[model samples]
Target: MESSSELADIKMVLAALMQGMNDTKGKAQVVEPKQEKPSAESEGVEGEEDVDIVQHETNAEEDKGDEGGLATYMKMHQDFYASLHYTRVQEMCKQKNIQYFRKDMGAWELARLDLQEYKDMLKGGKP
Candidate 1:
């Protein structure tokens, strides 16, 4: 008798929860985030990283004959490679046939590596 009464109580709670859940799912409000103008200092660093890469490559075309400049450009990219995502690092490991447990290490540590081969390995290679 007690078990049956408990079951009935459970069913009542479950029914209420099921109905309440529908309200939450369909009535959710989403607001667009306001974009902020970045400070000049930040504008030069993180904000310009992607743009720098594009600009750097184009600039390299103008200096194609400067082998030292080309090497320096590649080295500069590797120097800041720690800004890369962990999944990217994992992808590089996959491309280079390197075995690693992604969960066992961090993206920061992998990105901090000074190895240019690891950083650019996935640019046009097989995983």
Candidate 2:
């Protein structure tokens, strides 16, 4: 049989080990969560601002191209309509060889002009 003193020492060792484990767990609980850095793509505005910026840049480029000639502006307008899947609008513009003015126009104004042209085409008149 083992001595009582040895049993006491074993119990003390086990208790110390358990206490150390508890201390480690406590320290882990106190640790703060790591923070994430912002990515370049995610640094801009959420939804509307992103749309606005894109539209603004496109409009600025289109206006610069428009200053060259009506033919250039008309090509841009047709390309823009094609991208939006307005096949009838594209066909009509191509068949009629319509002239378009794209200078200094915002998104809303451009959209309005496109709609008006579409209506005019439907009515069998030149836009």
Cα lDDT listed for each candidate: 0.59, 0.56
Question: Which candidate leads the pack in TM-score?
Answer: 1
Give the CA lDDT, 0 to 100, for residue 97 in model 2. Answer: 55
Q: Model 1's lDDT to the true fold? A: 0.59
- In candidate 2 the C-alpha lDDT for residue 109 amounts to 43
Question: Weakest 10 consecutive residues, lDDT, candidate 1?
Answer: 103-112
Tens-place lDDT per residue, model 1, 1-127, is 9999999999999999988775665667998999999888787787344444354335665577654354555456554443566577677666655565662343433333433554465454766
Every model: Cα RMSD to truth: 15.7, 19.8
User: Local error of candidate 2 at 122, Å?
Assistant: 51
| Least accurate 10 contiguous residues by lDDT in model 2 | 99-108
User: Which candidate has the highest lDDT of all?
Assistant: 1
lDDT of 1 at 12: 100
Error of 2 at 96 (Å): 83
